[model samples]
Target: MSHAAALTLPFDTDTILEGLKSWAACESPTFDAAAVNRMMDIAGRELALLGANIDRIPGRLGLGDCVRARFPHPSGETTAGILILAHLDTVHPIGTLEKLPIRVEGPLCYGPGICDMKGGTYIAVEAIRQLLRAKVATPLPITVLLTCDEEIGSPSTRDLIEAEAARARYVLVPEPARPDGGVVTGRYAIARFNLRATGKPSHAGSRLGEGRSAIREICRQTLAIEEMTTEDCTFSVGVIHGGQWVNCVATHCDAEALSMAKRQEDLDAGVAKMLGLRATGNDVSLEVKRGVTRPVWEPDAGVMALYDKARYIANAIGFDIAHQSSGGGSDGNFTGAMGVPTLDGLGVSGAKMHTLEEHIEIASLVPRARLIAGLLTTLGA
Candidate 1:
């Protein structure tokens, strides 16, 4: 039997589900520092139970703390090893569990933040736990880093991620698996822009002609901004806020937009176009400011080599996993772009991410855990 096949027997589906539900129950939204920390605390306790040396880095920029757990090696090899990257935060608010409670129905399990990432994060921890229980000694030591701000583009944790990855031989991110049970080897470049429209305010009773309504200007600009979408680059305005009262012409409006491209040059050109936007109406001003961005991660020979090993392991475990260049952004983008051999989307297989209906296939938990355990044992050996 293959090494992965041997590891599969130790991961019980029921045990994995119970542990995963605890993570999903915490509801650590990205903006809620305390909630995110609570999730971190749970993770930290689990790692401590495994006898791993843990380091808790205090959060910055109003974000939650990050946890780094280093597993001791039998041979005491302190050189570069595997880095398992994960995030505990989700997009769902604090009380999402009331609507989407954690429960198993047939082969599918449902909960808030269950599919998007909590499932994957918990599985990684479980993989380590099983490995320790089985007394398996890997060729290299392992480190797991769980951050708190990936959903919001990882503003505070990007530097920490890169630093960890720079010293590691390989990086694995357990973001939600691809819809077809595939893995991610590359990701599209993404950019965010903040937009503002300013115009003169006037009363609606009589001087309507004298006022240039910022709300109207912003509406016109939103259409134009969305019209910039094309095959190479896509743009969308996701958030807009304006006008306070019906009686007076609004003097200010604000909006936010997101752009994605397969190439860095294409994303840069799109950024330039967005920043070059000019107001069509006289005396009105429009401004576009760039926000957080994720660079494109093109698969290299090293990346493909890592994927090949994962594919081989999956096949041995009685399943197959394909690879693709995904659209959504993750911390993998940072490490992959830095030329680190990174494999992402190795989490639970599921659908309806970032929605109330998010869930994972109960059948996927054991096989996926086996896949991760196989890599931890065989890679670099």
Candidate 2:
């Protein structure tokens, strides 16, 4: 079949949904390396079935492994091609299926990780499958890199993502489409920080005056950190832990904070402010440590040209796609910052991400797949 004729062919929604459900049912949360590896195993099997050259990179820093699947070109030419970037890890925990079981209701398909990514990842795979079955030859090779650590700032896979992206001509991230079925051309800068507060411990029932409560100190710091939100930068404390016994004062408290900005300079200022934080009292001490960071990705000329191509493809597919600068960071941030033509948010359309109410539009599966397939055939031509 000709490439144009193959692009016009409709995908089997039921088959795509079946594959996605299998992925979502695996319950691969970011912190659970074993669970994430199981998710990778399923993806690797699918890619292998498509005659892809597969490489499974083992996990490091207690994280899950990553899978790289490269589809060969018909002409036997090997060069920098398209990189389909997605993540197998979801924010949902292992037992979350019991709460948000996979099901179809009206036009939406509900399940954990369905909207946040697995849906888009499966759709990308299906697009390639359909093209192969139709014998449509793409102009360039395609590589799909499914990592296991995107939900938590991609701590373990950032280097790998950059390495793969550097070799590819274009990078596409299926990270849930924008609300209006649009794609992301730029992303805000993001930084994570670890906070610790230390205080003197003492019996709660007696001699309480001698104790400096770390919990109280942490509470004050949390409020201060949150209050730092501004038009240019925003801060939020996501995780905190302290106190072991009710009868004793807490000696230490730890917290994780995140800051985001539209510009890198703003994020840098935010980082400096976070690092300069001081304790409210002399009896207790505060320590701030910076963690993984995703730099701001403003759309350059190359990025805008890439978006134009995606826009043309979407329009040809009978849909209009707008472009915008999003807040949340993805692996695209790394590639985009490196001056690569990166496009993101090319995933399924849905809402309620990172929550039990997450889902994807059932009607969005086929069209989005077609769009991806169109890009695959046209890019690098």
For model 1, what is the error of residue 253's alpha carbon versus the real structure, in angstroms, after optimal superposition?
2.0
What TM-scores do the predictions have?
0.95, 0.98
Candidate 2 lDDT tens digits, 1-381: 122644576698888888888888899999999999999999999999999999999999999999999888764525888899999898899899999999998989999999889999999999999888877888888999999999899999999999998888899888899999999999999999999999999999987888999999999999999999999999999999999999899999999999999999999999999999999999999999999999999999998988888788777778899999999889899999998899999999999999989999988999899988888888877
Candidate 2: C-alpha lDDT:
0.91
Model 2 regions lying over 4 Å from their true place = 1-3, 74-78
Candidate 2 C-alpha error for residue 88, in Å = 0.7
- For all candidates in order, the CA lDDT equals 0.91, 0.91
lDDT minimum window of 10 residues, candidate 2:
1-10
Q: How accurate is candidate 1 locally (lDDT)?
A: 0.91
CA displacement after TM-score superposition, residue 159 of candidate 1 (Å)? 0.7
